[model samples]
Target: MQTSQQIVGQFRRKRLFIAAMVAVLVLVLTLSFRFFEEKSRIEQQSRDFANHTIARFDRMFSPLDVSANNTQALVGLRCGEVRFPLIENLASLQTVRAILLVDHGNIYCSSIYGERAISFSEAYPELAISSQRMLLTTDNYLLKGSPVLMLWTPKTLDNHSGLIQVINIELMSNYLLEPTLPWVERAVFNVGGKSLEYGNPLIEEALPSADEVSYEESSLRYPFSITLFGPPPARLALMTLPSQLPLALLLSMLTSYIVWLATANRMSMAWQISYGLTAKEFMVYCQPIINASSGNCDGIELLLRWHNARQGWIPPDVFIPLAERQNLIAPLTRFVITEMVAHLPVMPRCKSFHVAINVAASHFRDRAILDDLQTLWWPANPVPQLVVELTERDALPVVDQRVISHLHKVGVQLAIDDFGTGHSSLSYLKTLQPDVLKIDKMFTAAIGTDAINATVTDMVISLAQRLNISLVAEGVETEEQANYLRERGVDRLQGYFYARPMPLGDFPAWMDRHLAHIAA
Candidate 1:
């Protein structure tokens, strides 16, 4: 069987393992929440940027669309009368470079140069077909190779007569399509099927990779959209992970430590006593009860002593009372009975020799003590007589007389140990009619020193003698005390004066030596 210390060590290791697992679980959960939170923040940021840029593009094109529609009404009129109004319209809108009027499949008037005759269908064939259209195209004829945004508002449904407005789109691209670093590395502005990026020429295919794009937004009022592209939101969230690690580790460690501290009391001394029982660390000891007059050992009181593998030599004063409080004393008592039965060979095999074991008050409930004796002790059928000792500290309940009678019928003697120390002395005498009354060591030690206790001691001896009860004076340390007890007709004397409590295995050799000393 494993010792108590080994079991305790296993418990501590298990606790630490659980604590560490909890710490690791806490750390992982915290980081997961943080990563999702950061990803959400970056996604929102990208979305806002895309929307704001699309709004700027809508604002830029709205005024030009109104200007071209107004000028379309003057398309078939006299050029001399309406040409100056076209120049005034172009000057009013700062983004508009120029405006032109097309009349019956020909450009009839211009705001910048005067009158011209450019074919509407041949020069810009795509615009001639649509009634209202926005296009991103390069002005190769006038400002060669420079990108411009063109709006066509036709005067009639014939696809020939209309007004064309031109915007210097390259200058506007710098402000509306500027990239936001770290979040948005580049922004693209797409019109019709053509796309333009800030500080770069327009491209035929301006599609951003799905993995690299942060957010994309299309204008509701125009044929255009803005796309912001950079590293994925997931990657940005991960970049922030290093900064979040230290606090997460600290919190997880604090939680684990609190858990460890909270469980300390559960694994305290009471738990150790229980473990000690399982590990069989408790040893059975016996203090010899000498015959006061003959100086011959008549009986032995079985005592319990603990020697923990880790914490050695625990005192009875500490663990005994604790065991009773923790409801473990009964099991401990059962262990003592079992050990005594196993080591019965080491004891004197005579009916006159008694083996006394202390029983706690709780053990009397439901005739538990009687049951233990009958089940564990009576089966052994050892030669020595059995004595059940009740101490003054015990407060036994109203026991059924049948149980006591059964114990007496089985040749079990009842003794009241540590007599005259409690208020129940007279009550026990009236109820139990005990065979032996062991005087408390306090009164025995006070034999010659204190008169008041000495008188009480005398009374106890006299009372037992009158009742024909056997008297056992404990704590007899000197010849004076022994002589006094023997002179007073005390039936037995037990204390340091004879022999101290020793292990059950050593009793046989000690008895031989004691008998030899008595004979000498």
Candidate 2:
């Protein structure tokens, strides 16, 4: 048996928990997407860098290849002439380390040792007279006791002559090796099964596994590839993490707060309605219902009002529907009855002066309301006149003949409120046979206006007259409207034209003033 407060509290907690979970889910997805996006961007950058470096190498060395071809053609036409000026000019070039001219399996001319003949076959067995194609080699040649890259171009002029262009390995290494991006820990350059490397010494010393290499690209024009190694994917993701963390958190909180704001009203109303009965925020106000013909106040209709310390004022139209939807209407109606009974002593003594209290459809379904009314009315020597007003806005529950019969037996009166506004107004009127018919304010507002609404008002007056039912025209704000209803034999008028709904503390004074005005 959970109380309304407990149930409402539980529901609020559940909804807040769901909102938090949704926010967490959104944050997780955002971070995951950012991680992959950053990874893809870094990988693309690495590829671009590799391609640019390889293109740069081709641009740097293309001139050297052309020069080697020119040198071979010159030596072939000259038949290996020992020209000092020709060898001196070629050797003076910055990029050329040494040049050797070989003829008939023997070294004949040299830029470093002019006319110093050496056996080419004995000095370099790797160079064969039969090989006559241009070839580039990277190997440790003992001639300089260091690694060297040789461009060998063979020619035939009378006898076989070979032009050898020797380039120091250090020059090529400097051209190919440079520091890359911060994330790129190392860069490896491989050619003809031989390898060279540059970049962070720590990373070069302890090479990453093949699986750990982030990006690898090979030269499109040469027999070499560049492989880049960096921190693992996980580490790369972490390096870029802090930059996106704040934005992710902001998005998560913004979404969650919007959700909370959207539902804050409903949850607040639930709390107010749950504790309202005990906190005494719920109070009844009254508006005088005047006899249209006599110009005298006949009775007051009770209207519910809520004044919360925190929320200020909550109108009945807003909270009443909520209460009905939540099944809290029964308790609210009971509280109203109890409050009316407490105010019985202050009510006017005139028998004709009645107090009308609106009842919800839920009240008619059970005998509890009947029992409560009986207990409250039993003690009065002459119980105050009471009117039970049922609105047609909601359909009546299954006819509780027992409750209806008991109400009639106890000298209580019933009236249909807000007539013609509900889906089954006529059906309710025919079945319940209430003592009074209160025309809805929408029709009353149209009085003395257009032909259509005037005709509608006339017809309602005619219907009430024929059925012998007391008629009350509501919302008669203007003199023209009030006069029209009075002339049409409207039994009672209840609206702002007569008086606004007043607090109970002010109702008695207002009633006295109205009575005196009528007497005058």
Candidate 3:
């Protein structure tokens, strides 16, 4: 069978393992969710950038298309008659740098330099066909090195006559095709078989393939489309994942701590008890023991109180029985003794005034209780007497009479507490020959209401008087109960009616008030 200590150790290890597993689970789930979310965000950004660039392309060229269509009638007219009209049209359009007239496969007029004798098919074979509407090329006649978008409108369907509008696409490409990195590394404007990317002075010979494009958007009103290229959405999302690690770790730790706190009750309370002892979380409180006949406070019982750091104010019933069961009562009793010795100044400097503490039967083994008192208590040379109350809940071990005699010789008194609550009360009276018999609270509560128990209370008082032992009535709550016990010759009364248990440091003030009230 596992001992309590072994069980406590195993429980602690298991709780820590569970908390670590929860932390790892939380971290993995958070990072996975963030990765997918970032990927979706990057994908959306790419798509929006491509579509917005397409809309700008249409806006830049739609006016040029309208102006070119209006000038198509001047295609067959002489350059002398149509030159001024073309220049006026060009001046009205902000983007159009030049306009040309093409008739019967010959380029004969220009808005910037009129009366041109250039052959349409040799000079520009792509536009001479009159079938293609747009081309991204650097072959602008006036701006030699700059890229331009050529808008074509044919006068007739004979593959001969048309108007050509050269737009300054290179200048507009700065804002129109700008790439927003790291999602979009490059943005390209494609027309026919040519391509122009941001900040490029000349058109590219070939466009990017399908694999290199991240997102592509085409203009519904024009032939051109904007293509965005960069790392894949998943890769870009991964690159940004490092930035989120600190927050993910923090949240995981917080989640783990919360789980640990939630499961604290299930963890070993024995370990908590041991920890409380070491941390000095236990405190000493004293209930005033009033001399019933004189109504004078003559003694106080030192009670153990625990204030756990995590769980505040643990009741004595919860820990006392457990402490005895786990064999920890001996250490706890020693703690109470040490604390009493430290706070001895609070008690009156009179040997007749006693301070009492309950001690478990197991502490008597090998004279452990005696050694604790000698080591921690005797050195202080306290003015008040020390009383050890042995509850009848446990059978008193067979102790040497010399130990009891020696305790009596040194001013320590033995008392039987909670007298009738246990099975061995009468046997305890014969064996221990205690100096004091404390009538348990149940019998005191039966003072008026219970006839049989009240008879039993009277019998106990009669027994104590015949044995020449002083009697202390426990839980004397009402004045009638106090009067009944006092009239029955009970020597001392301990209950809330006199004074509730308070910190030992407050006892001096409480003693002064009680003495003053009695004197008044």
Question: Which number leads on TM-score?
Answer: 1
* lDDT per model vs. reference: 0.84, 0.72, 0.85
CA shift of 481, model 1, Å: 2.8
Write model 3 residue lDDT over 1-520, tens digit each, in one string.
Answer: 3344544566677788888899999999889889999999988988888888887778778777778778888889999999999999988998878898998899899988899999988877777753678877775467687898888888888768899888888878887877787888888888887888887877885355554555778889888888788878888778888998999999999999988887676576766788999898999898999998788888999899989776667788777877888788998998888888888876788988898999988888788888988899888988887889988778765665556667778778999999988887888778788999999999999999999999999999999999999999999899999999999899999998999999988999999999999999
Q: Provide backbone clash counts, one per model.
A: 0, 0, 0
TM-score of each: 0.57, 0.53, 0.55
lDDT of 1 at 95: 82
For candidate 1, lDDT tens digit of each residue in 1-520?
4444555576687668878888898899888889999999998988999888878878888888887777777889877888899888888998878787888999888787778888877777778864437778897667888888877877777877888888888888887888887888888877776888877875555656766864678999977778778888899999999999998899899988887877665555677888898898999999999998788999999999999776777788667777877788899999999999998887889999999999877777789888888789989879999998887687666755556667788778989988998778998898887889999999999988999999999999999999999998989999999998899899999999999999998899999999999999
Q: For model 1, what is the C-alpha lDDT against the true structure?
A: 0.84
Q: Which regions of candidate 2 fall more than 4 Å away from where they truly are?
A: 1-268, 308-312, 377-382
In the range 1-520, model 2's lDDT, one tens digit per residue, is 3344544575578669867987898788888889988877777777777888788766655666676666664453332364564466566556666777777777676666666567866665555543423223433333444445555666664335677777664565556666465667667665544455663221122356754665668767555566777766556876887899899999988887887776676556566687888799899888889999898888889888888665567667767877887778877887777777777777788789888888887777768668767666555554457888887767766667567667778778888888877777667667777788899898998876678877877987898899898998888898888888888899999999889998877887897888899889
Error of 3 at 501 (Å): 1.8
Weakest lDDT window of 10 consecutive positions for candidate 1: 1-10
Please list the Cα RMSD from the true structure of every candidate, rounded to 1 decimal place.
Answer: 11.2, 16.0, 13.3
The candidates, ranked best first by TM-score, are 1, 3, 2
